[model samples]
Target: MLTIWGRINSHNVKKVVWLGEEMGLAYDRRDVGGPFGMDEAYRTLNPNALIPTIEDDGFVLWESNSILRYLAASHGGEAFYPADAQRRASVERWMDWGFSWADAIRPIFFQLVRTEADKRDAALIERSVARAADLSAILDDVLGRQEWLSGDAFGIGDIPVAAYANTWFQLPVERPSRPNFERWYAALQDRAPFRDVVMIPLS
Candidate 1:
């Protein structure tokens, strides 16, 4: 069985685990990091002391995007990962873009979800929110022109962004509207794996 160590509420953890569900893989997901705290066993699996580390069979892997690519390429085959070089690159591009997106929006998520209401930095949040909304416009523009970031069909590319995007949409802050982005996000909400795992309330 695949053993995954991470707290379920984590954004990065959500992406990896949701992908496992998407691929119909039954995994043993454990609570680690955050309040759960990492033990020596978890550190042995991931020296980084991160929220997510996966041990599949005897192969151990860290990093959510790396795990996504590895699992998709190994198990999902041509249908999920794609065979053509350009097609695969397109899928990878969005996966890479997710890192930047995560950086931009993390403050907003942290302030709203983790920090106390009275203790939150309103100015920092305002500035950070603008940054996040501006960065998100890139997704809006691209999604407006295409059905999926993977092009035409849903693929491994959509998982990370969609997982992170749940917070963007659910957050209490106000931001400009992006019809196409909303449309794409709503479509993702219809997926069972997305609904079950990624649609969870912000923590």
Candidate 2:
């Protein structure tokens, strides 16, 4: 059995858990980060003390997006990861974009949603909101033409972006009217895997 170490509320962890559910892969999850507290054993598995570290058949892996790619390739094969070179590259670009956007917007999200109203950094949140909106518009345009990020079929590309999108939509900030983004998000909401794993209360 595979063991996942991370708190359920974590976006990175949620991505992995969501992938497992999507692939119908049964796995055990252990809480170790956030309020759960990390120990030496957990550190051994992920030296960075990150929230999502997985042990699959004695092979430990860290990095949330990397883990998602690995699981999709190992379990769902071409369906989730894709075999076509152009399709795979297109999906890979979205995955990479997700990480970059996360780094750009996460600090603002942390300050705005995760922190108390009294402790929130208004200036930082304002800047982050603008940046996040700009970034989201780019995604909105891409999703405008297709049902999924990578052409007509859903694949690994959707996972990482959707994880962050959940956070964006859940936040109190005002969002632009992006019909395409909304349509795509609505479809994801209908999925049991996404609802069960990614659609949790924001912490």
Candidate 3:
């Protein structure tokens, strides 16, 4: 069985766990970040001291997006990670975009979700929210033309983007309405893996 080390509430870890669920892969996830505290042994598996480090039958791997690509290619076939060069590159493009957006929006997420109101940086939060909205608008435009980031089908591209979207939509902030983004997110709601693994209450 695959051993996944991470706290479930972590966004990065959620990407991996959700992908595993979508593929119906049996795996065990250990709590290692946040209040759980990191273990020395876990550090050896992932030098970054990150929440998610998967050991698949002793084949250890770190980095959430890398894990997503691996699991999809290994088990989910072309449906999850396309075999075609251009198609796979398309998925990779959005995966990269997701990380970029994550960096932009994380400050807002940390301010509202992780920090107490009294200690929060109001200015930074506002800036981050504005930046996030700008980035998401770009996605909204792309989504307006395509059902999924990976073109017509839901594939590896959608996993990371959707994982981040879960946090974006849940945050208690004023957000401009992006109808296309909303429609795509609604479609994700119908997936069993999304509902069960990615839609949990934010920590």
- Highest lDDT model number: 3
Cα lDDT, all candidates: 0.89, 0.87, 0.90
TM-score of each: 0.97, 0.96, 0.97
**What are the clash counts of all predictions, listed in order?**
0, 0, 0
Give the per-residue lDDT of model 1 (tens digit) for 46-138.
999997789898999999999999999888898789889998998999999988888878898999889999999999889888987998799
Q: Which pairs, if any, clash in model 1? A: none
lDDT for 136 (candidate 2): 83
Flag regions of model 1 displaced more than 4 Å.
none
Better candidate number, 1 or 3, judged by lDDT: 3
Task: Output the lDDT of residue 128, model 3.
Answer: 83
Sort by lDDT, top down from the best: 3, 1, 2
TM-score of 2: 0.96
| Candidate 3 Cα outliers beyond 4 Å, as residue runs | none
lDDT of 3 by residue, 1-203 (tens): 98899999988999999989988899999999999999889898889988789998779999989999889887899889888998899899999889988887788888898999899999998898888899889889999999999899888899888998988999988889999999999999999999888899988
